[model samples]
Target chain A: SQTIHQWPATLVQPVGSPLSLECTVEGTSNPNLYWYRQAAGRGLQLLFYSVGIGQISSEVPQNLSASRPQDRQFILSSKKLLLSDSGFYLCAWSAIGDAAFFGQGTRLTVV
Target chain B: AQKVTQAQTEISVVEKEDVTLDCVYETRDTTYYLFWYKQPPSGELVFLIRRNSFDEQNEISGRYSWNFQKSTSSFNFTITASQVVDSAVYFCALSCSRVHTPLSPMDSSYKLIFGSGTRLLVRP
Candidate 1:
């Protein structure tokens, strides 16, 4: 069975502070990884997706960025947080032509 | 371009009542996929069902059922007997199949995108 781990389920940070959210998957290799953000009372928006290490495709142009350092490790980062950045961040992975699975997600609050 | 439209923003139903959630999608590709997910108060998006474009056979799983009509580009979900535990936000999503092409696999076209979501509230 595969499992995804997302750290710091909830975080409260002041505005302009750096942010780092890590996600990792086990029991799968070379899987497609994705990051999505869901604002309050809104649909989820794709943030970034990676097919392999050092390869990332960003969907929305914003202050956030994503990186795939290892095969199963994906990190979402920002140099300075914005008030609009607060949302539920989800990490997911899937095989080719298969349904995607999501992590528990991190709820970040930028004050 | 591929898109999913969930017409109903929110629905409320009493326990033991039947409720249906509607979803409509648009895509030029014939070999695409559609999915339904449930997001409860826990906040995790749980995959409910995945249907390929070619297979229009409706599926029934316990009290949950799905109807896929390709002609109308609609895939609707229904809960036979609603319960408080079934209260959650449901989302419809679509993804274009990875057609044989010279483009790199890393391209984001194969990625899945979600609809606006419909919040369902079942009163116990």
Candidate 2:
């Protein structure tokens, strides 16, 4: 069975702080990875996705960006955090014609 | 543009009551995919079901059933004899076939777009 692991399950960052959230997948190779954000009382918005190493696509340009440094390792980073960046960030992995599996998610609070 | 609409923002149901979560989608592509996901208070999304455009067959798994209607572009989920464990936010998503082009930039068509989600509260 495949499993997705995300770190810093909960994070509290001051405004203008740097942000780094990591996600990794095990038991699968060359899987599609994605980053999604959900604001309080709102639906999910696609942030970024990657098909392979060094291939990242931005769904919505903002303060955040994603990078696939390894085949199953994805990282979401920002040079500076904004108050609007507070939300639940989810990392997901999927194959073609299959259901995407999500991680536990990172609840980021910017104060 | 591919879009999924889960109009019901929230639903409340008593234990053992039957409930249905509606999902409506819009897309120009003839071949696409639909999915239902469950997000508990813990907040990780659990994959529930997946259906393709060509298959409109309704599926039932234990107390859960899915109704896929191609004519109406709707895929709805029903829970029979719901329990407190079923309390969660259900999301409906639409995805055009993945175009695994490592060289090409991905567009909305190759993305798994999600709806706003419906929060289901099953009280015990």
Candidate 3:
């Protein structure tokens, strides 16, 4: 059984502040990790995906960036947060030819 | 380029009634995959079903079933005797299969292209 942990489930920050959200998966090694953001009443948008340590693919250009410092650890960060960057962020992993498993998600609100 | 389209934005139905959510996708690849996921008020996306392009068989799992038609490029999900617990936003996604190229045993799975979701509301 694999489990994913995401921290600071909910956060509120003043505009122009920095942001960091961490996600870690246990029980699986070398799993495909992804970062997604969902705006209120909108669809999930793929932000970044990592194939391995130090290898990341960005799906869209935004104020966000992702890094895989370890095989099971993925971090989403931003040097300066924008009001538009606020949304519900999700981290997920999957094996080849398998369905993806998502974490609880982090709700970020930048005002 | 792959794209997923969920035609219905919102649907409301009474409890115990049957409901069907429609999904249409576009991809040029011969080998691709389609999936349906549920996101409840908890805000967690739950995997429902996955259909590979090679298999067109319709399947029934308990109160849930899926219909796949390659000709129409549609994959639809139906819930029989729907319950309030079934109320949630449903998403349709598409992914191209990793063909021939032997992937390392540790390669991360390919990414899924997602569609705008449909919110399903089951009322009592």
True contacts kept of each: 0.70, 0.64, 0.64
Q: Candidate 2's residue-wise lDDT over B1-124, tens digit each? A: 8889999999999999999999999999888989999999889899999999999999999999999998899999999999999999999998887465546555556678999999999998
Candidates ranked by TM-score, best first?
Answer: 1, 2, 3
* C-alpha lDDT values of all predictions: 0.92, 0.92, 0.89
Worst 10 residues of 1 chain B by lDDT: B99-108
Candidate 2 lDDT score relative to the true structure: 0.92
Candidate 3 per-residue C-alpha lDDT over A1-111 given as tens digits, one digit per residue, 9 for 90 to 100: 999998879999988999999999999998888899999989999998877788788889988999999999999999999999999999998765568889999999999
Best of the two (1, 3) by TM-score = 1
* Evaluation by DockQ, superior candidate among 1 and 2: 1
Cα lDDT for residue B118, candidate 3: 93
Q: Write the per-residue lDDT of candidate 1 for residues A11-74, one digit (tens) a residue.
A: 9999999999999999999888999999998898999988889988998899999999999999
TM-score of chain A of each: 0.98, 0.98, 0.98
TM-score to true structure, per model: 0.96, 0.95, 0.93
DockQ of 2: 0.73
Binned by DockQ into CAPRI classes (incorrect, acceptable, medium, high), candidate 2 is: medium
Q: Each prediction's DockQ?
A: 0.77, 0.73, 0.56
